[model samples]
Target: MFAEFRKFVMRGNVLDLAVAVIIGAAFATITKSLTDDVIMPVVGWIFGGFDFSSYFIRLGPIPEGYTGSVNNYAALKEAGVPLLGYGAFVTTVINFLILAFIIFLIVRSVNRMLARFEHQKPEVPAAEPTDVVLLREIRDELRKRPAE
Candidate 1:
């Protein structure tokens, strides 16, 4: 059992998968940061600097006494309101697009490199010509026969 376990651990495919998982996790973090911290804010600034996150409609009812705009989704939800978080969904979609684009570029590069390697002609041993072999055989026979 120990030997089998050792073999499984030492397999090339397993090692490759472990490395891929580590790298993928690291890449995910980087892309998440880029999407959330950098891209979304710029997009938010573009449309009259209105923050989409603060945009939500209150469904149930606005209290007659309380008159203030609900700046967050949680506040509206607490007021017995059904909220549609379209902005959050858009942000999530952006994150997915960024991550997917990064992955696509990586996969494309790897595929190009692999395709280049695959298309390279392999060195093959030259085959002996049939006529050459026949000629050699005839020469050998002439030499082997005793002089008349």
Candidate 2:
């Protein structure tokens, strides 16, 4: 059973999948940072600096003994207030779209590069065998001779 497990783990596909998962995790982190740190701020600025991070609506009343600010979503949630956080949802959607667009551009460029390479003809030709060369020369010489 141990040897079977080891064999399964050592298979080329399994190893490739593990590496892909690790790389995908790293790529997700980078895209998340690009969305959160770079794009969202610019989008916020474009929309008059409206920050969606704090956008939430309280559905239930605050707890009677709560002393925290009512406007704070975290505080309100802590105080047992039911809330709707539409802003966070919107922000997440925006992040997904940006990440998808970036990935699409990368895939498109890579595909174009691959196609260019595929279309290129090889610079060097393989040498023909001596017999084929001699046969072709004989055939050409016979064609060049005038009939008697």
Note each model's CA RMSD in angstroms.
5.4, 4.3
**For each candidate, what is the lDDT?**
0.80, 0.82
| lDDT (10s digit) by residue, model 1, range 56-142 | 555566656554556667666666567777777787888889999989998999999999988896968899999999999999999
Can you write out model 2's per-residue Cα lDDT over 1-148, one digit (the tens) per residue? 9999999999999999999899878888888788777877777778676565557887778878888898787778767789997766777888788778888999999999998998895668889999999999999999999998
**Model 1, position 25: C-alpha lDDT score:** 91
Candidate 2 error regions (>4 Å)? 48-50, 78-80, 121-148
Deviation in Å, model 2, residue 77 alpha carbon:
3.4
